[model samples]
Target: MVLSMGIKVGITDTTFARVDMASVAVKKLNEMTSKVQIIRYTVPGMKDLPVACKKLIEEQGCEIVLALGMPGGKDKDKVCAHEASQGLMMAQLMTNKHIIEVFVHEDEAKDGKELDWLAKRRAVEHAENIYYMLFDQKYLEKQAGMGLREGFEDVGPAKR
Candidate 1:
């Protein structure tokens, strides 16, 4: 759980909707720890996230990246989300760094209140994760005990 003082963390988000939540969270987290510097980048939409992340690492010398974008409730948004996720993963692999992708789809909630709640919650949660990723060996140890899996969610063991 140790990082050099003033470690660089890149925070990228889309200029769409209220994705500003991510920016706010990153700033708050930065203030809380004071051990990391927050580098901010903004893109027009979800599709631009990957490039932002890549530049942050390669150009900005960031150790970790937190990307936030909100996909509206449209067919195109869903498709774009998938494409963005792919790019994000690719960037991570190419750069040999961790990218915390946090996207809250517009359709995920029943109403505006829920949507707002989801977006803010996810943004803050990922920001906190950034801290853990850079400074918490105990948290990493516990994650390892959660049963690793090949695909996305750790669905535990097969239940016949």
Candidate 2:
């Protein structure tokens, strides 16, 4: 929907335990969309991210950072997942110029089966609340404008 609307989107998959295929998908999106920027991740270290993000800005001229927070497991993993997500948020906050957005999925059952419709609906509602907690229009607009200035020429209307 973002792409269709012409918004340049950059994706970061901070899925715990292992990187997922969505990272690859976002990279490919960079190729397909003139406005997209795909950032590479560096191993978490004391000073690596700040240095790496500087380079990403200097080299790729990236403006916004979106962090995807998929957990390694189910509810039992919430503590670790929350910590990881918080760490990423703190890092992004430290970077004064880049706007950060975090996406977190709802806890799933151990069996990893598809959620029933009601459960899915609740998850969607919860995710919406989470997004509100994490960001507001001012921040989003700043990120969107920065993205456009950086190289995301395709300006998309806000997603409904």
Candidate 3:
């Protein structure tokens, strides 16, 4: 159901992220369609995303949310990321809404350039996914089980 304020899409990002992923997503969404009211919330770190997202949905009337983060390479960072992910999942369950977790680990890239590239690619792709999820379920259904990856190349369907 579309709200009178338009289709409200929330984006929550972390200050710890080296790249500006939220901007990329906003640009992608803007390019894909019009009349979408994008609500953005910036947090200090990944762990703070759940509350920010929840607030966007509950308080700001957002229909869907995108939680973008960048976890460090250390083991502790991984653990923190895991915890934050759990919170995001719980928020989804509690709100009965979709919160797309877009996380890019620092170690996923070999260099700064690759990290930037991954962040932009992931943000743009996931923004498209949001469009699909909100407006084109048939398209996603047709691509089901196709091993679609956000930051990296899609693996496609498995060999039969």
Query: Mind giving the per-residue lDDT tens digits that candidate 2 earns over 3-102?
Result: 4433333334432423342344454444444444456554342123344444454455555544444444456556655665555556566655453433
| Candidate 1 local lDDT, 1-160, one digit each (tens) | 8756698999888888664776667766876698898888988998999999999999999999988888989898899999999999999999999998888888878888888877787777777778878899688678764554321235664455
**lDDT value, candidate 3, whole model:** 0.96
* Candidate 3: tens digits of C-alpha lDDT, residues 1-160: 7556569999999999999999999999999999689999999999999999999999999999999999999999999999999999999999999999999999999999999999999999999999999999999999999998998899988997
Sort by TM-score, best first: what order?
3, 1, 2
Residue 17 lDDT (model 2): 21
**What are the lDDT figures for the candidates, one per model?**
0.83, 0.41, 0.96
Question: Which portions of model 1 show Cα errors greater than 4 Å?
Answer: 1-5, 143-160
Ranking of predictions according to lDDT: 3, 1, 2
Best by TM-score: 3
Candidate 2 has a TM-score of 0.41
Task: Compute the lDDT of residue 115 as modeled in candidate 3.
Answer: 98
